[model samples]
Target: MDWDRHNRHIYNKVIDSFAVIGKELASPVVLAENTYSVDEAGILSSVLNSLKVLAGRHELKTHRGACVERTLITSIECISADSRHLKPLIIWPATTHRSTWTTHPTRGWHYGHCGSGYTDTMISLHWI
Candidate 1:
């Protein structure tokens, strides 16, 4: 493969131009205080497969068939370069909120629900 041809210098130039413009507009400290990095992660409540197990000779069949139900939970976190962070937004896989889920609530964290346990456009807008 021709590395130089595939590397796309135009895209790099565009990014470098943006960097220059950003540096001209704001100082490092001001940028750090105002800019935030956001990220999202998904968690599975249960795994269907187990790596290690101990079973009786007669119970192997039953053990193989056993599996736990899983729920998909999504969490969105935001932080700034100044070492400050906002409370995470948690997304559950339900159409409506469940009170039992938050028996002990987190003080400032936010929660939302959707049919699929993932962040959609509306959820992202609300978070923003």
Candidate 2:
């Protein structure tokens, strides 16, 4: 039961599992809305940041740099409730702007924006 020893490993494994699930559930149209949820969004942000750092280390040419940066910022804003408008929080530059729909535009920017029902306070605390 000393799971603490492998806590980080387990967390990474779980996150990897979720990535597989996201890819499976996501279709040809891998829109941001399909990968909804604060946890998923946060995971994405973390992964993007890690990749960005690694890319910088290895000097890999990546177009995803901008997309990942935008997504990371949006995810942070969503999780932090820093922005009241979910459009900026959920709208990603990964695809065409006009084709995207407004998702969770009232929940104070957090994923699954359930307006006035903030849950990221706990997550933000853990992150800090």
**Candidate number with greatest lDDT:** 1
Whole-model alpha-carbon lDDT for candidate 2: 0.42
Q: List pairs with backbone clashes in candidate 2.
A: none
lDDT of each: 0.83, 0.42
Best by TM-score: 1
Estimate the TM-score of every prediction: 0.61, 0.22
Q: Which residue window of length 10 is worst by lDDT in model 1?
A: 1-10
Error of 2 at 17 (Å): 1.8
TM-score of 1: 0.61
When summed lDDT is taken over every stretch of 10 residues in candidate 2, the lowest stretch is 79-88
Tens digits of per-residue lDDT, candidate 1, 11-111, equal 78878998996886587456667777799999988666656467876666667645567899999999986889978999999999999888888999999
Over 91-128, each residue of candidate 2 has an lDDT whose tens digit, in order, gives: 23332344233543564442333222232454355433
Clashes of 1: 0
**Between which residue pairs do clashes occur in model 1?**
none
